[model samples]
Target: MKDPMDLDTPLKPPPAPGSDSPATAAPEARRDRTAPEAQRTDAPKRRSILGRVLAWLVVLALIGGGVWWFAFRPAPEMAARGGPGGFRPGMPTASPVVTATVEKGDMPIRLNGLGTVSSLATVTVRPQVGGQLTQVAFTEGQAVQKGDFLAEVDPRPFQLAVEQAEAQLLRDQALLKNARLDLERYRLLVKQDSIAKQQRDTQESLVQQYEGTVKADQVAVENAKLNLSYTRITAPVSGRAGLRLVDPGNYVTVGEAGGLVVITQVQPISVLFTLPEDNIPAIMARLRDGAHLPVTAYDRTRDRVLATGTLTTVDNQIDVTTGTVKLRAQFDNADQSLFPNQFVNVQLLVDTLAGVPMVPVAAVQRGAPGTYVYVVNGEDSTASVRPVTLGASDGAKTVITKGVQPGETVVIQGADRLREGAKVAATDGAAQPAAPTPSSEGPRPQRRPQRNAS
Candidate 1:
């Protein structure tokens, strides 16, 4: 065991391959001590703090922007400049109402009526004598003249009767001549005492009675002639014939109670109408002043004029029951627009005024202080409250007698939510406003502040 190998072991394996040198350990110790300190010193910590601060600033900016926008924006129903149809709450809205021009032209005061057309002359055709109807000369609906024969009665019996009466009259006349000659002879004999006085007087009385008999025979003959003439029925007046009420061979008679046929005149016709009593004064004044009152009738459904005429006559008194006054108008029946009992609406123009101021009735508002209108004024087109006096109203338009001018623009449909001096926007792209119009009334066409359109 005490060999050389044992001696090497006892020497500790040659100092464990230079473990006794401190220089080598020094390098490892320096590395271990400096590593943690270098890591601590070189780490970028300030960058992380700056990143958190930047993120916070961005979040604050976003929140501030949202708050500012929510607080300052206008509400939804309003428009720019606080007018209608553009943008914010409590602003005006587009109106659905219709409007008309404030014209500076004639304004006619009128009286309207309802009317019907009828003929001037009408007649009924009937038999004048009692007889059998032998012939019908006219058709059922034929036009006739005054003397035209309408029908004929059987003439054989009437002719025979007339001849007999004539024969009797001639016999009476011959007897009358013989009696006169006899009376002359008797008078001469009585004067010569050739005959008694009683005899002469008796002869004279006989002659006078014969003369009366001849006169009576003549009258009978004339009556028979008249009866014969009446057998032929003629039209009493010229007119159009209606449907035949009797046919040929009908037993027509003078005693027949009812009418056989009716006839109506067709040429120049007339219309009867009535107007409310409220329109009477105006119409009468115009008529008295020599103004021609024109009247028109329109078809019911289409509102087209079917006839036109002038006021011919008016009733002396108003109809108290209907609160209406009767009027009659004459029309030329050239187009035959008028028919008997035809119903029509009538527009009677009583009078007209030149250069009168009238506007759409929709612009007139019934305010607390009577009637008023909203007039747009200034360069901003702001609404201004104006009191107005109204004249005649035609349901669609009103005559403004005072307060507003002719050419001024009045707010028609945009006044419900509007206040005085609030802005406006005209729908025809004329949003650019003009100056205020002058205040004078009567005939104003294209006011002084009329500006060029947008």
Candidate 2:
């Protein structure tokens, strides 16, 4: 055992070659060697403990920073938008909008209906007598006047009949003349008592029979002449002829379904249109006053005006199935603008409201508040919702019966997203200027030209 309090410590020599015995050393030498190994092991443990402490400290610092940011920091968007925690609150936002001025104008009330062009007279030409068609005098599609020669049928048969009837009439006339002379002689003989009374009566009866035969022959001759005239066919009405149904050299008969030809009078044409039954009262009232309501016909697209005319008459009864009534309008059609069976759009100027306050239709809005408009105050540059009483609208402009005055500006576009007192930036960027206020002059313009853009 080593001394407990040994002060002198010495180093020990290493083992020699070939020495098998385990090497032994003084207590101090052994202590020095073991002390270095223990010191190395303990150094690593201290370093590991110090590193763990540093890792825990860094994690705690990150958690503290996240808590502060999530709980105490303000949102960037809210700050910029000027909310309670906003960066700016003095500036106000204005909604962009387009505007127009209200003006007093003549608003015409017009009714529109789909109509079809019809001919005043349509005739199907046919033969009155049966015969071979020898000649077609009129060309197809040719405009012919009434009584114009159209076609001719074979006249040889009719002419022969006329000759035979005339010859029979001549023969009967000679016999009748002979009988009359005999009857006169019989009467003279009876008066002189030279013959019996019964003989004179028999002779008189024979004379009457001959006269009746001559009269029958004369009737046959007139009938044959009338049949001959029928061989020359003529137009019954003035119109434009259609395609010929029966060509020359073909046999035709009377009352044939497929007639010789069809003719339509287009010069003074008529249009048949329909209107709702609800409109009958107003139309009848105007008609009773002898008013000739003007009507305009438009093309299929309602883009071009084909012709203009006056309302002529209304149908006597309404069409119950469709709840509509038929109306007829007449046009001179001098230029042949309207054709038979052509579909068209018709506009009837019913009545014109004169000198009424009007505004663009786009300015009108319907919402929780029945009908309203956004009236823009020029001085404050703000928009306000104003309720209005509407009268009539011509698609482009509407009549304001109440709640709006002339010379005031109203928001025509961008009324959405607007509050009662919302600020607005108004711009007058419409295609056409406000319509001209109507004058009590000639007549009210039925429709506003499509040039007015909202």
Candidate 3:
């Protein structure tokens, strides 16, 4: 509630004790003095805050750089040292490996196949005539020769048939004889005019009819004899007999499912095998030249040779489904090593390379480029990779057509650690000469012995 003019007016402090001045000072002077002091104090605070922010930025940059270096660094061993053919420092000097010298030898070209032993002749003996089985003459699993008695049926019935046929033949013969006698008498009667011509003709016809009957009876007798012989069954071939099928007292007939016994010729047996159809051309060429190729049969594991044989024949046609051809080989199984239906592995020697550079099959290794081998340097005992061309292999030795020569050493074992110029030592525990290094000088010369003064 004061006056408006009084509110607008400013107040001032009391004057100093010794001065006599006005009570109020200029307002502009007071504002100017305080503004300058406030600016000075705020300037120092701004500079200190900026310095702390820059220091924090520097620390964060240092931490990010260290994390990147640790995460992306390469392994020590795999990192390149100086250049190619140079290994890292502190690495082992040489790798120990087994080696073999390449040699010139004859290598056989062989074809391997799976086969089954079969008999040249297998017979199932059965009764030709139906009757009760009376006796078995041969034991099971017995070896018998041709015409050996195997079993017998009851021969009494066959014998009775033969006797009946013989009696009928005798009766017809007597009738024929009587008719001939009557014909002779009829001709004599007609010539003497004692009997009519018609009567003589009738008698002649009777004689002819009786002669035909006698001939028919003779054939019956022969047939009956043949049946009698069949009652005593004999082996049609020479072989080892199998288990008896029809025991004594069993009624066996000609139409029985399984025969009485089975006979298989094992002494001179055969094997049936199949080979890839691609090999047929080579095999046929050898056969055409009248060369008797040798075939060997081994057990299922191919560890032991069962028998040696000659290639007997080849099938005319190839199997379409499997792209193979069947071949038969005959063996003189003298030791009875081959048995019927036995599984075996077969090898056929088709051709032989007279002289070829060969090495152990283990020396060959496949890489990205192709097949290669590790060839050891003779002077320095260091290994270098050599790409090679391969030929036929017999599972143990391989024929090297190129990239290797006779008497050159090749690494066969412990080659996993080998590089292009790696040093290698023999694994056989033999003392090996020290590998030549880059700093090694040539062989030192020896001074001649000085002559003694006289």
Candidate 4:
């Protein structure tokens, strides 16, 4: 009755001899057994977590090393070789250049300016007397000489006026002759005591009056002749005729606004130009020395030479507004290359500097120091920077006052790519690249080819 439930439970194990009693040993053993089983079950899980953490740490370390290698790597060529004097070492490529020999010759000092082609004389052919324009004698744009017939007005009216003047003159001459005969008769009667002196004086006075009338008639005839001559308009100057202003059958007058045609003298033409006021003293000095300065006229592009001439005159005063003085140059424009009112470039050779060291203007270069040139050394095919003192320049050549010698070669073309003590491959002729000099930083980096994506 007391252990009907206890009979269903298992029996407890007996304790060892030296150990505590069975009741006490049973509880201790149970606790020890349960602790060991729990520890064994958790061991595998702790080891698995530790392994996972270590694997992640290894992956992170590999990624960091790869990033450093790719970003901080040096170029293959630079890493393979070292440079001298802290500059990268490589075979310097020789720059191709064109050279010119410094020469000892005359360099003309010239003053350049813009100019206008003008006629030595310009005339507007207009009718001197008013009448109907009856004829145009010259063709448009025709060359004409002075006094050449250009146009004609109607001459009928002028002819009639001339005839009337002639008739009047004849009438007055007849009257004068009759009066003179009567005066002669009266003088003879007075001398013979047949007529009074008063009567003779009256006849003499009548003759004088008639003579005066005849003289007046003569003046009228001359005037009428002059007017008739004016009916034929003539070119006042030798020149090329412009377009006709008044057509035939149009009534023209002396007071017309624009003349019949304009004529401009193109041959032996004059060029009107201006130079800075400061140049006046030099120009005047040369002029006083009896030097006939040479002037050259070029087309607008300044490439083609139109004519060569001599300086004719300088204006009296400098223009206050422009600070320039006007100059005139005369050219024998035989080819008619220069036209009236055309724009041109003028170069006046004021003086010549003889026995000066000169070089092509392209050889001169400006830098922080001043003017310089790249002089090619003959001993070694290399170029060196040479400082030079620049004097007068004639556009094509420049005078080098110092630091360069005659017969020495200087780089004219491809100087922009030069450095001090740079090797060069020079050509004898003028054909050379005009590219500018490379910068001083260094040679440009070589580009790398990209790989195709897989």
TM-score per prediction, in order, is: 0.64, 0.68, 0.68, 0.66
For every candidate in turn, the CA RMSD to the true structure comes to 18.9, 13.7, 16.4, 13.9
- Output the lDDT of residue 1, model 1: 53
Tens digits of lDDT, candidate 1, 1-454: 5677764555533456647467678898899999999888767687788889999999999999999887764322344354465445455443322223467866766555556677787887777788888988888778788888888889888888889989998998898888888889989998999989898788888889888988988888888888889888888877678888888878887856665778777656777888788888877887899877887765543245787778888899988898998898877766877676777667777777777787776688886867888777637666778899998756556788898887787876756755656566654213435335332122111212335782
How much is the lDDT of residue 263 in candidate 2? 93
Q: Which candidate is the best by TM-score?
A: 3
lDDT by candidate, in order shown? 0.73, 0.86, 0.86, 0.85
Model 3 poorest ten-residue lDDT run: 439-448
In what order do the candidates fall by TM-score, top score first?
3, 2, 4, 1
lDDT of 1: 0.73
**Pairs with steric clashes in candidate 4:** 416-437, 417-437
The lowest-lDDT stretch of 10 consecutive residues in candidate 1 is 439-448
What TM-score would you give candidate 2 relative to the actual structure? 0.68
Model 1 stretches astray by more than 4 angstroms: 1-101, 180-211, 284-292, 316-318, 378-380, 393-396, 427-454
lDDT of 3 by residue, 30-102 (tens): 7789999999999999999999999999999998888887666432234336568875675435677888888
Q: Let me know the TM-score candidate 4 reaches against the reference structure.
A: 0.66
Q: Give the per-residue lDDT of model 2 (tens digit) for 274-389.
A: 99999999889988988889999887766568999999999999898999999999998888889999988888988889999999878999999989999999889988899999
Query: Model 2, which residues run further than 4 Å from truth?
Result: 1-98, 171-215, 377-382, 423-454
